[model samples]
Each structure stands twice: as structure tokens, then as C-alpha cells.
Target: MTLANGGDNIGIYTPSFAIRSAHEIIVIAVVFVVMTALWCFVAHAIVNHPKLGSPIRRCGHRVTPFVLVGLGVLILYQAGSFGLLLGRSGF
Candidate 1:
């Protein structure tokens, strides 16, 4: 996104920066969704299955509550973002 025209005098940003920002937002969303789904699957596997008796499964069972809370935090973050976009506190 190099919009600098030889650095003679003018200062202007490139148009592609906006597109880059949009791409970053989409990537972040996809990453969050994938991570949340993974966490839930691991949590459910540890909680409900009798065959998954490994140390990692024990850890996942213990960590499932916090994973759920982390999901709540993620949702709160999205709510705050929507509030910022609307220029008001989310009711």
C-alpha cells in the first residue's frame, strides 16, 4: 500500500489499506469461530466420554468451565465492537 508518490511533497495513504483492514477483520472472525468450535468439541469430548481417560482429557475436563467463560468474553468483545460502530452503549 505504498501511495507515496516519490515523497516530493504530498502525503497520502494508499486505497488498499482499507481493503487490508477488511481482510484482517474477516480473518480474525474466522479464527475466533474455528477456535471456539475446537474448544467446545474438546470440552464435550472430555466431559461426556468415558474412553477419553488420558491426562489431556483430564485437563480438558478441568478447563472446560474456563473455556466457556472465555467464549462469553469473546461475545462481550463483539458486543462492544458493535456498540462502538453505533456510537452508543449497547442496551
Candidate 2:
């Protein structure tokens, strides 16, 4: 967004940038909740229904475990990294 505003600097926080970041965080949270719900639905479908939708069935059969682990790792990484950044940001 700063790029759209013609600001080339990185890591320089303006009020607008902070507002945009807040909005982005909200969006990320909503997406995370939706994805988690979908994952649960797909998992339930795969387990309870033998003839589930093919794409979701394939994903649940093959990718669900790995995706779960990856989600955990990603959450940890993002938390730690953003914490470090906030700590350094003089807040």
C-alpha cells in the first residue's frame, strides 16, 4: 500500500501504513478461520462418507496431515518473527 502511495521505503511506519496493516491482520484472521472450518468439513466428509467430493477427498487422504503440521509451523514462525519486529519497532 505504501508502494501505491509512492513511498519506496520499507519498514518505515506511517499512520496509514499502520491502519493498512491492521486491516490486513483482520483479513488474515478471517481467512484463517474460514480455512480451518473448511479443513474440518473436508476431514469429516472424507471419514464419514466413502464417496466424497473427489478433490477434497484426495486432499484429505494425502495432504491433510502435512497441511496441519505446516499450519502449526507457520503460525509459530509468524508469531515469533512479528514479535521480534514489534520489539524492535520501538513500540
Candidate 3:
């Protein structure tokens, strides 16, 4: 997921920059790696802590599936609309 987001950020933001060079790309990659590592460590610590972990875990279990289902439904709706549009256009 982080990789996908990084790729998307690169795709969406890189073109507007004045200089698109190896140095810039390397810097972006390094920053992305560091930030991802930092966040992973933070999340790990939070999830493993004795005080807060249990409630967070329980909430995650309850909420994650519904969030995923919502995303799935949204994707399906968009795809269905696109398909309908294409068909109407005789594509």
C-alpha cells in the first residue's frame, strides 16, 4: 500500500517540478523509505503496547471489514457506471 501510494504521488506530482533528475528521484525515494519505516515502527509500537493494544485491536476487527466493504461497493459502482457509459457510446 505504501509503495502504491508512493508510485501514485510520483505520478501525480513529479511532472510539475522544474528539474526531473536522478538526484530528485533518489531524494524522494529516500524520504519515502524513511517515512514508511517511521510509521511502521510507530504503528507496531502502538499495536503491541499492553495498555492500548487490546481496544484498538478489537475496534479494528469490528471496523475494518465494513471499511473494506464500503470501498468495494464504491469501486463496483464506479465500474458499473463506466461500463454503462461505454455501452451507450457504442464502445
C-alpha TM-scores of all predictions? 0.33, 0.37, 0.42
Which sequence of candidate numbers ranks them by lDDT, best first? 3, 2, 1
Largest lDDT belongs to which candidate?
3
What is the TM-score of candidate 3? 0.42
Candidate 1: where is the Cα deviation over 4 Å?
1-20, 49-91
Clashes of each: 0, 0, 0
User: lDDT of each structure?
Assistant: 0.56, 0.57, 0.65
Question: lDDT tens digits, residues 4-90, model 1?
Answer: 444521211122123357777678668868997898898677756676657665575688679756755555455464465578765
TM-score winner among the candidates? 3
- Output the TM-score of candidate 1: 0.33
Q: Residue 57, candidate 1: how far off, in angstroms?
A: 13
Q: Once superposed on the true structure, which residue ranges of model 3 sit more than 4 Å away at CA?
A: 4-23, 61-91
Q: For model 2, how does the per-residue alpha-carbon lDDT over 6-59 read when each residue is reduced to its tens digit?
A: 442332333324545677868866886899789889767776775666666557
The sequence of per-residue lDDT tens digits that candidate 3 reaches over residues 1-91 is 7446576444434443333578877887788799989988998999999999999888988887797667655544443543555675221
